[model samples]
Target: MRRVHKALWWASWCWPGCDNQAMLVEKNVPLQSFNSFGILAKALSMLRVRSDADVDALLSNPSLKAVPKFVLGGGSNIVLTGDVKALVLKVEIMGKQLVGETAKAWIVEAGAGENWHELVRWTLESGYPGLENLALIPGTVGATPVQNIGAYGVELQDRFDSLDAIDLVSGQHFTLSAAQCAFGYRDSVFKHQSIDGEGGKPGFGLAGRALITRVRFSLPKNFKPILGYADIEKKMAQSGWNAAAGAPSAMQIFEWICEIRQAKLPDPKVIGNAGSFFKNPTVSLEQCADIIQREPKIVHYPLVDGTVKLAAGWLIDACGWKGKSIGKAGVYERQALVLVNRGDRANPVTGGEVMTLAKAIQTSVYERFGIMLEPEPVVV
Candidate 1:
């Protein structure tokens, strides 16, 4: 195993066949600190990819070419069931810059490994206010498009420009437009497995085969803060700002979102959690009406498309899971949608325990509401 110092990286990349040109492959890397859950796990082999060139070099290496790989980002949205057997490609790619601008929008691009919330802040601080509504999301920029992440009245697809990714199998660098990504609620092409088409043509899905390198967001020139959610409205009322008189600034909305989230969700640093444990289940109007008839106080939001999105937290709370524990995993007291690690770092909750609690919650919610809650985190 060849190891090159950080200072020598540029020199090694510049000079081919250098003794230190081999990609750094760390062995038996502990992953407790890597994942938000703080579950104990180890990656047998790991590589920190700083750039697409590093990915190309990794693929060209005969020893690593055939090994299965996991592209890890902030590790905030995953649960480790056990030690990872595949080679973990930890994305450390870092950069954020104003790429370009059009008449209506300012285009900003950030490296995949750049922190998601930091990017939102940087964009706002840089005089781009479109991303302020998505403040405090925990993950990498790469994971944003993959998950179609959204908050308050804005979704990533609303501001997405395009993204750069590397095809893991062909080692081909490609760019995807928003349409090509096929973004949906908490899903994109990246979340599904590739389908085999006739004549060996790729059908749909890029899961496990594409590594996102950079994400580009289009911030509108005429920025309007997204304040449709009840939480934001409550914040406005508390602040004595009348919506009819004037709207809050993007910065104010950002701060309000930060405060709202802080009050409701536990900090992952203090309490191990993967943010919202489940996706808010969407149902048709008739179905929602039926459920509403049984449970008159069910919290739901009607979408423009006539579908109703129910609050998963309310369902869980109604099922008596809030602040409840199963083994080392527990539902967050403030927000029942969030599952937390009730154990300390030295005795952290296992992935099995988290899933067990989640399953129990799902069963309870389903029995009560007739809606099965889907988990948001990817279980590894």
Candidate 2:
């Protein structure tokens, strides 16, 4: 096995025609800068992947390929528990363009490294408007489908066109349509691991095996704004922008969503946090009814499929965890669904502390409501 040192390789140092020479691998790199949670950690080895060529080059090195690898994007949705042992591939691909347009839709593609919120703003500015509902969500474009991120009544799957990725194990590039991603409520094939037996079901799981290079969104033409989300409704009423006058434009909704999120959620730059710490647990109508009988003031919404989605923040607040702290990790005062790093840049929250507080909240919520709150961020 070849050992990586803390150094940079020059272009002339690499072999001609082989990508390995171009891929620079750094060692013992500090990671507090990469993750949004501001947790201090280190990567034993890390490589910045700017393109598919970089991936190919890294794989061409037998020593690098022999070890486990971790694909990191914006680091907004992960809690680093400790130093990463795997080779870290930090995706930094960059591009944004209108790939094509049909009678019904416009397809816009972005590199995996592009900021999701910026992408939304770009789409609206570029005259493609469907992604406005999802504005201000943290993390990179590539991580969106992995989490099936949604906000203001719109989910990534609703805007997804397709994505191109490379199989880490085979080093082969492949494309997957939205259906192949199998997106669900804060879940996707990327969240699941490959099954050993049964050859795995089609469109099942691909976690840890695929590195998404680019993502394409299908923004419909002649767009209609998706409104009526409680926050959006509140904003509309406050601004006196009635949907009845005419469906508010995508730009208006985007601005409102941005304002709403800023008011509610803690800025990661100012207060380190990974958006929502828990997924809003979904339950059967019967379960919701039973909980309602006991709690009476429970917050919930009915889904199209006859299920109810409970407000995880409401559950957490009911458990009296808002603004509560365990060492350097604490729940945001404004939103119980979020967990913040109470420490400063020099001494940030540790991953262990975050998980401990998370587990405690999970236990309390489960004990009271019989529903275990599932965490939204990936615990690494």
Candidate 3:
């Protein structure tokens, strides 16, 4: 173990102005259990942040503040390349409640560390029903905003209200509205790095600089289920429910989504994998039309904006990658979008293997379809 500096040691003890109530800075911590991929790695220094005060306490120490920090949420959307040398702040903040209600919607707030799926379930059970389409999505609340996570027919930006975050560099607590988040398809300001514009204007990006503390959602009071996805439609047909006659309740939609996801996606606990390795690539109508002419069976959805979203899983399966393995990494047989660790706990897949397979898939897809698949997971 590395020796703790005097200032760091003192700050840990003096935080919150109480004895034995210090911020614990763990060293050489094993991270296999922390990450959903089950990749074996070690954090040279780690801190489990349970509250905003913990961040304040960590930032208060100059020695700790100067070191590079990595904010880890549920670890569902990251690929660790190797042992992390930076100080890892594992967010564990927890809480969820209805903050306010309006004629238009009900405002709900959740701690960043809260399980995203659990939060979705809570909202529905508590009578707030907007998050049903996103049921069974992995990762934490903090991570959801970062990726602008979406499923079925709804995206996070659809329900996002605002979020609280602490600036790691400035030690400033701040809040951002949905517009400020700049949510895109599986992307947000948090995924980008700061950049300077043409005229020395500041560009928007919060990656590595902001530590999300809490997130607020605005679930519409007049609940309307977002349907039309093939999976949901199939479920509705199976249950003999017609949208024209009467729509299913929010709970029903949630249950259907859960079943759909479970059938398609492997549970991270049972199988070492991340959900949806690639974003469904979007292309212009002309490009989609050209591809359609070449390959009539290509799975695609037409977006309202005159663009087409191509199903990445279908593309991978088309390329004959399904049920195939490259070392310890393999494309899932059921859903080619997911890459799994074929190795057991004793000899798990390395991040290198995952990336190698991902690169090969990207190359193959790009070469065949002229569409380069973008990986969803952040490589750390």
| Per-model TM against the reference | 0.94, 0.95, 0.95
lDDT of 2 by residue, 1-380 (tens): 87644354333335447654455678788999899999999998888999898888766667677789999999999999999999899999999999999999999999999999999999999999899999899999999999999998999999999999999988999999988998999999899888645565554589999999999999999898888688889999999977468889999999999999999999999999999999999999999999999999998999999999999999999999999999999999999999999999999999999999999999999999999988999888
Candidate 1 ranges with C-alpha deviation above 4 Å:
1-19, 196-203, 243-245
Per-residue lDDT of candidate 3, residues 182-217 (tens digit): 999998999887766567667689889999999999
What's the lDDT of the predicted structure labeled candidate 3?
A: 0.91
Q: Which ten residues in a row have the lowest lDDT in candidate 3?
A: 5-14
Query: When superposed on Cα atoms, how far off is each prediction in RMSD?
Result: 3.4, 2.9, 2.9
lDDT of 1 by residue, 104-166 (tens): 999999999999999999888889989888889898999999999988889999999999999
lDDT of 1: 0.90
Error of 3 at 351 (Å): 0.1
Off by over 4 Å in 3: 1-12, 196-202, 243-245
Give the whole-model CA lDDT for all candidates, comma-separated: 0.90, 0.91, 0.91
Candidate 3 to native Cα RMSD, angstroms: 2.9
- Give residue 61's lDDT in candidate 2 (0 to 100): 65
Off by over 4 Å in 2: 1-22, 196-203
Instruction: Please tell me which model should have the higher lDDT, number 1 or number 2.
Output: 2
TM-score of 2: 0.95
TM-score attained by model 3: 0.95
Clashing pairs in 2: none
Count of clashes in candidate 2: 0
